[model samples]
Target: MNKKQKKVLTRIIIASVLMIILVLLPLEDYPLVRFILFMVPYFTVGYDILLKAFKGIKNKQVFDENFLMAIATVGAIALGEYTEGVAVMLFYQIGELFQSYAVGKSRRNISQLMDIRPDFANVMVDGVLEQVDPDDVEIGSEIVVQPGEKIPIDGVVIDGNATLDTAALTGESVPRTAKIGDEVISGCINMSGVLTIRTTKEFGESTVSKILDLVENASSKKSKPENFISKFARIYTPVVCYSALALAVIPPVVRLIMGIDPLWTQWVYRALTFLVISCPCALVISIPLTFFAGIGGASRAGVLVKGSNYLDALSRSKIVVMDKTGTLTKGVFEVTKVQAVDISEEELLEMTAMAEAFSNHPISRSLKEAYGKPIDTSLVSDVEEISGHGVKANVSGKVVQVGNEKLMNSIGVQVEDIVEPGTVIHVAIDGKYHGYILISDMLKEHSKEAIIGLKRAGISKTVMLTGDSKKVADLVAADLGLDEVCAELLPGDKVSKVEELLATKTDKEQLIFVGDGINDAPVLSRADIGVAMGALGSDAAIEAADVVLMDDDPSSIVKAIGISKKCMRIVYENIYFAIGIKVACLILGAVGIANMWIAIFADVGVMVLAVLNAIRALSVKKYK
Candidate 1:
């Protein structure tokens, strides 16, 4: 506990001991002395509440929970119910102490998840390791990360290999292997060996910075139910205060008019009980706490939810639309087959890899990898990119085109159709039909199980959207058992398809669009919920997506949905339970059937129960 909570606990202990001693004393004959003794305990634990109530009244905000509590206890004191008044405030402080401890626990959990923020960078300066602030390090500077140290900036490894503990970012305990020429992001712990890295991004634009920014701004965007409760509290507090006033005065005046005793003290006591029972502490505190805990739990599981509203929408999601490349499949392409008719296989592969080397597309990288040797850039010239077809480059003084069948047809070079399930890249030399190299993208390890998990988790429809060919898309769809497949689409076509799907779904059901987060911005924003998969260091995906999975795992989506559904269930449970108890106690208090003890339970007891239930959102390990 912090110092403040400790002080409150001390006061609660002192006040409770005083109340217990006063109750045991026989001071019935000394009314003045008994009242003075009870005032000590009443003011001790409730002074802060009274001061806050006075400040609220001074600031023209008089109808809050503090004001309700102060008026109820002070009125009971005025009616000579000293023991009950002191007991009410003492119990309320105990509840407040519990709430403070619960909130402290939650903040500590979230802080541990965000502990990946790096403090310093080890820069190689003048042949010596100089520790400097991470923000001062510039791009391309060689920084050394020792074992048990965090990689301060996003960069490429240039010297050593190490096992990286990415659990802080990905929530998965498996260590990732980082070797020479591999890109490593910030916030990962180098567990095994010392490594030298060349910085690729500045500190502000790194993955750690973006993730911290997302989490810090999350609470500013409240959920719909949370907003409703805020508005309800504003109106509910004043209405209850007025009702308590009427309950105190109307019944006594009617009794006098009916020619009987007014029973003013009895009615006034009932009104004080009514005021205590009507305080909206439970609804005001537990609902937001539930959502805060949900966000923290999801972060601990490697899923970043931008706001509570996204969590709400994810719970109602029914249709799941996913991009094929980089979302379901491993976005890496590789050469599966190589066929050459005129030239030797080596010559054809060399010519095609040279022609495609200038492009940074995934297919180009795969072909260059298959070549296994660096290209002499001077041998390739006049590179042209045919929009949807492929590339045409002058390779070794010969016009070579490496693309799909449409590129060969546009060049008037006809080739036999090959029935291959993977992508086929046809090759042509000097406008003559040569051969094709069949390339294919493999599925991620969890892609198939992710589909089944979504179905098991209650998702209705699963679809795949891709720019791949019909044959390739159909093969992947069949392998994964997707309900629908839309292939050979441009970026704009994907948005149009999402819009069409949105039109087909019911308004109550939400639609989710999962993308690679690099090139799917337009579609991501157009869907009901946009999830970016494997978006550890991609800034575009982090900015465009509503939900981001730190690792390249499809099953994280299912877990995310599970967390959201569980959180919303807890939210409704607290809302209904608090309000139901409060209303029932309020009716009974007004009718004089309930007393100050019941009012304390209705206010503080219900709050404690609600808070305990809200804290359940923190531990989500059993979600799987």
Candidate 2:
């Protein structure tokens, strides 16, 4: 507990004990003495509230709930209902204590998830190691990370190798091996090796810093349910206060005018009970706590939720649109077949690798990998890359063409049709068509399982949107059993498609779009909820998305959706529980059917239970 909570607890305990002692004494025979003792407990337990009420009135915020509570309880004491006034103050304090505890617990959870930021870095300058601020570490500078230390910046390894624990960043327990020439990301711990790295990014642009920024600013985005409570509290508090006042004054005044004994004390006691029961603690505390816990739970699973509003939208998503490359597919090209006519397969691969060595396309990389070693670029001459087609160059004094069917047809080389479910690259040597190489992109390991999980999570439709060809998109969608496929679309086209989908959604349904490419930024922003896959290495994806799946796994989407649904469930549960109890007690208090003890249950006991229910949103099993 914080110091303020401790002080409040101490004051409440001391005041309650004093009130009990005063009540047990022979103070009924001395009405003045009994009244003074009651005033002692009332002032001790409720002085801060009264002070806040007065300050709020002076600041022109007189309609606040604190003002209402203070006036009602103090009015009860004035009418000789001393025990009700003291008990109301004491119970309200207890409710405040529970709220403080819930807030503290939520802070602890968020802090644990956001502890990935490193404080210092070891910068090497003038052949010597020097300690410096993380922000001071520039790009291209060499830094040393010791065992149990966080990687200060994103960089490439220059010297040593180590096993890195990326669980805090990816929620995956598997240790990754890093060696010379390999890339290392920030926010991962170097488990057991002394590693020297050449920084490729500044500290401000590092992964850890970006993740911290996302988690820290998440709460600024309000959810729908939280907004509802804020609006409800604004109108609810003052109305109840005035009604309680009318209940206290109108009945006694009517009885006195009618020549009957005016029972002012009993009616005033009911007004105090009414005030205690109407406190907005339960609704105000539980709604935001639910969202906080949901965001914390998602961060622990490597899913960064930018706001609670997105979580609520994700829970109601009916149509899920996804990108094929980098999202559903493995996004890695592989050499599936080498069809050779005149030359052998090895000769064809060797000649093509030499010609395609200068290209950075995925197909060129796969051809180079087929040769299994770096080629001598000096042997290649007259190199030319055809835009949207392929490359042509002179390898070892012979002209070679490495491209698709369009390039082959443009160069007047006729090749036989090959029926294959993959990309076809035509190759030619010395003015004669040699053969065509067929390559394909593989699907991710968890793509099918994620589709199944989405169906189980109540998603009605699954669609694939990609810039890839119609054939490839259809094959991938069919293999994954998706309901729809939209292919060969540019960034603007994707946005238009999402707009069309949005038009079909009802007020109760939501649409979510998932993508990982820089080109998908438009669509990500256009959708109701944008989920970025493989966001760990992509800066544009992180910036454009509402939620980021750090692990690049499709299965995390299911987990994210499931967690969102569970959080919404908890929020509704708390809302109904709080409102039901408050309404029942309010009616009973106005009719004189309930006392101060029952009013305490409506205020403090219901608040504690609702807060505890909100914390259940942090449980991992809800997703499992």
Candidate 3:
């Protein structure tokens, strides 16, 4: 417990002891002394609430639970039910103490998330290490990280090698090896050798800063259920207060009109009980607590949800649309097959590598890597790249055309059909068909499990959308067991395809799109819930996405869905449970069948139970 909770707990204990002492005293002979002793316990247990009630009344906000509790207990005191009034206040304070502790427990997760905030950054100054604020570190500056120190900014390793513990950033316990030229994001702990890194991004624009900002602002975006409870409390409180007033007055007037002696105290007592039952504390506190715990739990699992609204929407998602590259696959291309017609395989590869040596495209890099030798620029001349087709160049005094079938056809070369399930690059020398090189991307180790997990989580369909050829897309879709495939789409076409899918889905069902490329940003924003592979995803895509999987593992998507489902379940359960019990007790209190002790159960007891259930949202690992 926090200091305030401990203090409140102390007050509760003291008030209970005083009440017990008064109950034991001979109070019949000393009625004035008995009243004084009762007031002592009452004021001791509830002085803060009474003061708050008076302050709320002075500020023209007179309908809160504080006011309700103060008036109910004060009315009981005025009716000579001193012990019952003190007990109500004492138990109410106990409930408030429980609420404070529960909220603190939930907020501690967010505080642990904030632990990633760097206290200081080590920058190199004239061969000397200097400690500086992370925010003051400029881009392109060299920062030195020692063993067991957090990387203070996103940067590339320029000097040393080390293993990094990325648990703070990605929740992955496995330590990752980092070497020269590898990019390391901020918030990772350098676990071994010392490293010097050249900062690629300013501290404010770094990954750690963005994630902290995302988590801090999440509570502002409340879910539909939370908003409804907020509105319900606003309208329900005043209406119930007026209704209780009428309950106290109208029934007593009716008794008088019937020529019977009006039992004013009996009717008034029921009104006070009604006021206590109608506090709306359970619904107001538990719904938002459920979502907050879910977000915290997801963060611990390396899924960063931007807000509760997205978390709620994810629970209702039916279809998942995914980008093929980087999301499900390793996204790194490698030469898997080589086909040569007139010349040997080495000859075709060397020619293609010579033609692509001047280009920096991923496919070009794969071809160059396959050759595994540096290109002699003197042997290559007149290099020209045809947009959307291929590259044309003269290598060793021989003209070579290396590209797709479209380039071979345009150059008057009859390209042979290759029924390969990979990206095929056609090679032609001196306008004659040479062959094709098949470069394929490897799938992620967990990609198949991710699809199965999604299906198990109740996702109705899984679809793959990619700019890759139909043959490659279909092969990947079949391998991953996807329900549908959309291939050869540009960035804009992907958006249109998502729109078509959205139109086909039920109105209440959501379509979630996951991607990890700059081109995927548009489609990410277009989907109902956008999940990004943050570790390797582009900054734009990460910014556009609603949720981020920090380790770039596709399986975390299913885990995120599981967390959302659990959270929403808790939210709905609390809503139904609190409202069901409250409505039943309100009716009983209005008819004088329930008294102050029952009122405490209906209000404070219900809130404590709902809060305990809401805390269940933090235990989301089993759901995965």
Give the top-scoring candidate (lDDT): 1
> Residue 350, candidate 1: how far off, in angstroms?
10
Off by over 4 Å in 3: 339-359, 371-403, 406-416, 426-435, 535-537, 622-624
Expressed as tens digits, the lDDT of each residue in 350-405 for candidate 2 is 99999998888878999999889779989999999999889999999999999888
User: Ten-residue segment with the worst summed lDDT in candidate 1?
Assistant: 615-624
Residue pairs clashing, model 2? none
How accurate locally, in lDDT, is each candidate?
0.93, 0.88, 0.89
**Compared with the true structure, what per-residue lDDT tens digits does model 1 show for residues 1-624?**
999998999999999999999999999999999999998999889999999999999999999988988999999999999999998899888888998899899989999987899999999888999999999999899999999999999999999999999998999999999999999999999999999999999999999989989988889888888999999999999999999999999989999999999999999999999998998989999999999999999998899999999999999999999999899988888898999988888888899999997899988888989989989999999999999999999988999999988998898988887877687999999988788898889889989999998998789999999998898899899999999999999999999999999999998899999999999999999999999999999988999999998989999899999999999999999999999999999999998899999999999999999999999998877343
Q: Please identify which of the two predictions, 1 or 3, would achieve the higher lDDT against the true structure.
A: 1
Q: What's the TM for model 3?
A: 0.92
Each candidate structure's TM-score, on Cα atoms with residue i matched to residue i, is 0.90, 0.91, 0.92
Instruction: Evaluate model 1: give its lDDT.
Output: 0.93
After superposition, the stretches of candidate 1 with alpha carbons farther than 4 Å from their true spots are 336-418, 425-437, 622-624
Q: Look at candidate 2 and tell me the lDDT of residue 113.
A: 68
Give the poorly placed runs of model 2, Cα more than 4 Å off.
125-127, 337-360, 373-402, 406-420, 426-436, 622-624
